[model samples]
Target chain A: MTNEEIRDFIQTAIAENRVMLFMKGTPEQPACGFSMRTSAALNALGVQYAALDILPDPRIRQELSAISNWPTIPQLFVDGELVGGCDIVTEMYESGELAQRVGVEQPQHEPEPPTAEAPQSAPLGVENRLS
Target chain B: MPTATELKERIESALPGSEANVEDLTGGGDHFRAEIVSDRFAGLSRIEQHRLVYDVFGTEIGGPIHALSLKTTTPEGQR
Candidate 1:
């Protein structure tokens, strides 16, 4: 699909689904770790949501990033607005904000064990470790 | 691929007077986490704040830079 068509498709999906996720894979089988975590957060809450796999067409992600101005997959939209990506969603889920935003009660489950509250505050090193 | 320092420089230069701390999360040079403190982020929402940082990288994001996790705050919001 052309970029315009892709944008329209995204708009319709967002408008139609109260809770929509533009992820790399389906919730049942996520293609990326970030996607898995984000979807898990929603599932843990037991909130019904719609998922669209961006892997099928590269243009879907390209248009999504362009229209949302959020250059990331696993983008969540609530009530037709961009909520955020994994980190933000994870933080919010931990803080109980994500449940409220999605209009669902926080799931009754094991509370996240208290630890270092700061997210990725420590850096391993400056050198590229991938090499 | 942009090194952590190069990415940090780009962030700091893009948002003048802002303090940026970058880390190569996976050591693969693709995934990274950044902490940015600047008055520019003071009034923005979380989504907007993240977008500001993402805007600096533009199309490079999700391409050369596989992931850029961000933590943004204002000077007053510093911990």
Candidate 2:
């Protein structure tokens, strides 16, 4: 598809889905760690979301990065606005901001917060660390 | 692939007076984690701050640099 067509496709998808994730794979079988963590955060919140796999077409990612100006996959959209990727989503999930943004009631249980102060530069667990 | 030091230098140079700490998360010279503190970030939202850093790499991002987990803040925001 041409860049214009891809842009249109992305715009339509965002408008059509209230909570959407442009990820590497489906929520059930995410291809990347960031995708997995973002999907997992949405699942943990029990919020319904639409997942589109970008692996089918390289143009999907190309167009997405161009339009979003965000050089990452696993991009989440809520109420038609870009929320963020795994790190931001995971942080929001921990802070209860995601639920608020999604307009969903928080689940009865919450995940435990980090217990120890980590090294400032340690890769956040949600990020990909594959060599 | 750009080394973590190279990426760090790029960021620090692009945002003058910024402090950048970059680490290769996987030692692969691809996936990286960057912690940046800059006075330039004072009024920007987290997203905007991140975008500034990202723009420095432009196409290198999502290409040679497969991932860059960013932690950006103003000096005042840093702990």
Candidate 3:
């Protein structure tokens, strides 16, 4: 597909979906470390969302980079809007804003896994059905 | 792929009367940041103004250039 076409498709998907994440891999199988981390953060927030893999089509990744002006993959879109990349998501998670944005009741805070108990959850906001 | 100069030119040429300071933030040949000023942004929402800058790059945004961190303001807003 043309770059503009891809960009439009992605933008529309986001606009129509309430919560979405465009990542390198699926929530069940994150292809990149960044995506993995974001998955973890989303899980911590306890929200359902969709993760679109940009790996199959290099163009999707390229088009997304152009549309968001963000270099990295694993972008988070909340309520059909671009939230930042992993870093931004992590920051928002730390601030508990990520949970708030997605309409999930805040789970009690827990330290990141392999350190302290990270509450009861898996990584990723992979409620792909929602988006 | 667009060279830094070409991207700069596209941004400046497309944005008439916008005084922008565009730079290659990464020096890796893709990422950029622009501090753009214009009177057109007086009442526009932040998202609208950002979208205006995004419009400049069009489809070339993600391919050759990777990032664009923007700070936008009107001549009066800058004060």
Best by DockQ: 1
Model 3 C-alpha lDDT per residue in residues B9-67, reported as the tens digit of each score: 77678878878887776678777777788877778755566667778876555556665
Show the lowest summed lDDT stretch of 10 residues, model 3 chain A.
Answer: A111-120
DockQ scores for all the models shown?
A: 0.66, 0.52, 0.10
**lDDT (0-100) at residue A104 of candidate 2?**
78
Question: Could you tell me how far off, in angstroms, the CA of residue B7 lies in candidate 1 after the best superposition?
Answer: 1.3
Candidate 1, A1-131: lDDT as tens digits: 46787788788888988888888766666799888888778777767787888887788887888888788998999998999998888878888999899888876654762222222222111121111
The sequence of per-residue lDDT tens digits that candidate 2 reaches over residues A91-126 is 788878888999977666667542212212222122
lDDT by residue for model 2 over B1-79, one digit each (tens)?
7898999899999999999999999999999999999999888766687789889998888889999998887889841
Chain A TM-score for predicted structure 3: 0.79
Q: What are the lDDT scores of the predictions, listed in order?
A: 0.80, 0.78, 0.68
For candidate 3, write residues A19-68 as lDDT tens digits.
Answer: 77888776667776667778777766666666678877788877777777
Q: Docking quality tier of candidate 3?
A: incorrect
TM-score, per-candidate, Cα-based = 0.85, 0.85, 0.55
Whole-model alpha-carbon lDDT for candidate 2: 0.78
Highest lDDT model number? 1
Clashing pairs in 3: A39-A124, A49-A127, A66-B62
